[model samples]
Every structure is written in C-alpha cells, then in structure tokens.
Target: MNWKIGLADNWRRLHTKGTVVLSGGLALVTAFGPAIIDAWNSMPPDLKALLPQGIQRYAALGAFLLILVVRYLAVRRKGGGDGAA
Candidate 1:
C-alpha cells in the first residue's frame, strides 16, 4: 500500500482550501470593502490607534482561516476521512 497517494491527497486538499480562501477574500473585499473601510474610519481614535493600517486585511485573513479550520474539523468529525485517499 503506497503512502504517497495519501500525501498527495492532503496536498491537494490544502491547495484547494488555500485557493478558496484567497478567492473568497477577494470576493469579500470587492463586495463589502466600502462598508469595512467606513467602519474602520468610524472607530474610536484610541481603538483605531491600537491597530495599524491594513488591519482590516489581516482581520479578513484571520476570519477566513478560522472558517476554513472549523469547516475542516467539522468534516473530519463527520467521517470524511481523508476524502477518498
């Protein structure tokens, strides 16, 4: 029984998730970016001062990563089991 197939399958899954995250992030930025910028601008000065420019981008990335991780765990719990590998 070859183990390389399992490794390849995992790599493909990770690549797919990464692509989904990036594309989803781009779509989110295109859709709600104005609202995000407005919200940031409206934040209290002291609070805003705690985070530097591009914080929104970082927040978006963090949110997406959290989402992906949760979804992956949920699927794993549901017995997806390496997805046919």
Candidate 2:
C-alpha cells in the first residue's frame, strides 16, 4: 500500500532534522557508488590507453558540469509555476 505523507502541514518536521539526515545519507551513497564504478571502469588496459590521460580528465570534468546543468534544469522545470499565464 502507498502511504505517502502529506506535506501541506508540518513542513518543519520534514525540513528540520529528517531531511538533513536523509540528504546526507543519499549524498554519501551517490558519491561512493561513482568512485567504485570509476575504479572498475578504469581497469581495462586497451581502453584506458586509447583515451589518454589529459583527454579523459577533461571529458570527466565536462560530464560533471553537464550533470549540474541538467539538475538545474530539472529543478527549474519542477518549480517554474508550470508556465502559467
């Protein structure tokens, strides 16, 4: 059964302590997962040599910036007042 709590009241209950803890936990998981994945992904010998160190670092930085941009767009879309006239 789906028992989603309503946020219409008690915003503080969600925002004060619970949200901070939840966010911190999720941030840890998100960060740690990528590190593990990157370690495995960098293991192959031929593929690593093909990309070269400098290009791979630049590409990784660009991918991170793109992720941030996508997240900003998603937040804006959710909170853009639905483009109401």
Candidate 3:
C-alpha cells in the first residue's frame, strides 16, 4: 500500500541530502582548497607513490563537488531569484 509514494519520497530525500552535502563540501574546498592540495602534494614519496588511487579519488571528489554547486546555482538562478525554488 503506497510503496511507490514511499520510494519517491525516499529518493527525493536522498537527492536533497546529496545537494546539501555536496554544497557544503564545495564551499569547504573553495575555502581551503590550497591547503588540501598542498597536503595532498606533501604526502611522502612512498605514500604518494603507493596511494595514487586515493589521491585521485579525493581530487575527483573535489571536482565533483565544484560541479554540483555550479549546477545547483545555475538551476536556482534559472528558476528565478525571487527565492521561489
């Protein structure tokens, strides 16, 4: 009974949560991006050599976050600046 509605609601909640989480992450990266990049670069030679995958993942995370925020803002602007959507 009403499982479809429940599923839609769950998906909506997940998407909204992702938007908020990614927005915050994007803001953080914008604020302290240099430090983050610096720390990543400062990893020891062996560690950097060993953890290329992890390093790439975090860099991707940062880029993904940046894209999310830009998309969100673009959508919001398109909807209108009346604080509607």
Candidate 4:
C-alpha cells in the first residue's frame, strides 16, 4: 500500500497507453506523409509566410519536445522522484 508503489503502477499504466497511442499516431502520419507534403506544398505562399522563413519547422519540433518534457515532469513528480517504474 505504499504511495510509491501506487505511483509506479499508475505510471506503468499510463506508459502502456501512451505507447499504443504513439504507435497508432506514427502509423497514421506515415500513411499520410505524402499527401501531407503535397498539401503543404500546395499551400499559398502568403499563408506559409505567417511563420518566419526557416524557423517554423524547428519551432514545431521545439513545441513537441516541450510538451514531452512537461508530461515527463508531471509523471515524475507524481511518482515522488524515486525513479519508480
């Protein structure tokens, strides 16, 4: 009944679910990659210009990484930082 054990179990459950979701998402992106690229290419130049040249892709990557870090921290904090599970 230790809290750390409870947190470990919770984290394991969340990790399994996250893995499944990530796998499905990656498959979907792969399936749509070509079409997505075509649509982006067909987008209007002005619309694309909303983001500064050469930085949009990096910005998106940074945002995704930030989200991942936030999720990690939240889970770690809930688990009391004992490196459980």
Candidate 5:
C-alpha cells in the first residue's frame, strides 16, 4: 500500500486504543486534580528545588507529550500498519 493508505490504516487501527488511553488520563486528572494540587503545594522546598525552576508547572504536560512522541517513534520503527495486529 502507499504510505498515505498505510498511515490512514494505522490510524484507524490505533484510534480506539489512543482514545481509551487519553480518556483514562483525563479521568485520573479530573478525579485527582485537587489532591494533586494540594500535594504540589505542600511539597517541601528542598524537594521541590530538586526540579529545575519553572518545570513544576509543565511537568505533566511534558511527560504526556514525551509519552506520545515515544509511542509514535516506536510505532514508526515497527513499520506501523505493516506490523502484525
């Protein structure tokens, strides 16, 4: 198949799994948002200092993006729709 067809096929096969993962993540954040913020607020200064300045705010977003990038790379390396289902 052409690359475009293969890409579309891969996306169709992967879309449900991606949706579930993203939905679950959103649910967890919604359930824990308050407690998570409280924990972050209560973190000791020394421990908080271990992270780079200004990183605390973006850490979750960065981690989520990193997971996506890694998954995409792994899928590409596996030849996407060419791989066995």
Candidate 6:
C-alpha cells in the first residue's frame, strides 16, 4: 500500500476526541519552534549553566518523553483505552 494512504488510514483509525487539541498543540509548536529555540539560546549564562554542558537538548527531550510516558501509563490505568481522556 502507498505510504500516504496507509498514513491517512491509520490516522482515521487512531484519531480520538483529543485529536483536535493535539493537532492544535502541534500547530502551535511548529509555528513557534524557531522562537522557542531562540529564547532557549538567549537565556542568561547562569540560567543555562543549571544544566550540564552538551546535555541541554538531550535532557529536555528526555524530560518531555518521560512526561509522555507517565501520561500514557496514567491513561492506561484509568482504562482510557482510546486515550481520549
């Protein structure tokens, strides 16, 4: 099957009530990505120094993924099988 068709089908199948909110969040993130990066880069040296050198991006990504994993587990515990809650 074509990748585009498969993606569309999977999206339709997986979409839930929270899809709109998720889509909106993604749109906002995409729109503000550059500004967000610029802000991070412009933080005061002392503030940036809080994180270890060369690990800022990885730390941020790990924290974000951890939150997502926790949320996923919470939803599963709540029996939110479709993750709409």
**Alpha-carbon lDDT, every model:** 0.68, 0.60, 0.68, 0.65, 0.68, 0.64
Model 6 vs. true fold: TM: 0.41
Q: What is the TM-score of each candidate against the true structure?
A: 0.42, 0.30, 0.40, 0.45, 0.47, 0.41
Q: Which ten residues in a row have the lowest lDDT in candidate 2?
A: 70-79
Residue range 1-85, candidate 4, lDDT tens digits? 6554345456656644544465466567668879987988999999988967777477557656755765565333455666765
Off by over 4 Å in 4: 1-16, 59-85
Show where candidate 6 strays beyond 4 Å: 1-16, 52-85
Instruction: Give candidate 1 regions above 4 Å deviation.
Output: 1-18, 53-83
lDDT of 5 by residue, 1-57 (tens): 655434544565665564446657767876998998899899999999898888855
Report the poorest 10 consecutive residues by lDDT, candidate 1. 71-80
Tens-place lDDT per residue, model 3, 36-72, is: 8899788788877776566667876778877767666
Candidate 4 clashing pairs?
none
Instruction: List the pairs of residues colliding in candidate 1.
Output: none
The clash tally of candidate 2 reads 0
Ranking by TM-score: 5, 4, 1, 6, 3, 2
Model 2 gets an lDDT of: 0.60
The residue-by-residue lDDT of candidate 6 on 1-85, one tens digit each, is 6554335455764544244445556568768889988998899999988878878577557656755664455333366576655
Q: What value of lDDT does candidate 3 attain over all alpha carbons?
A: 0.68
Q: Which 10 residues in a row give candidate 6 its minimum summed lDDT?
A: 70-79
- TM-score result, candidate 5: 0.47
Writing each residue's lDDT as its tens digit, candidate 2 over 50-84 gives 76668746855765665556445422245467592
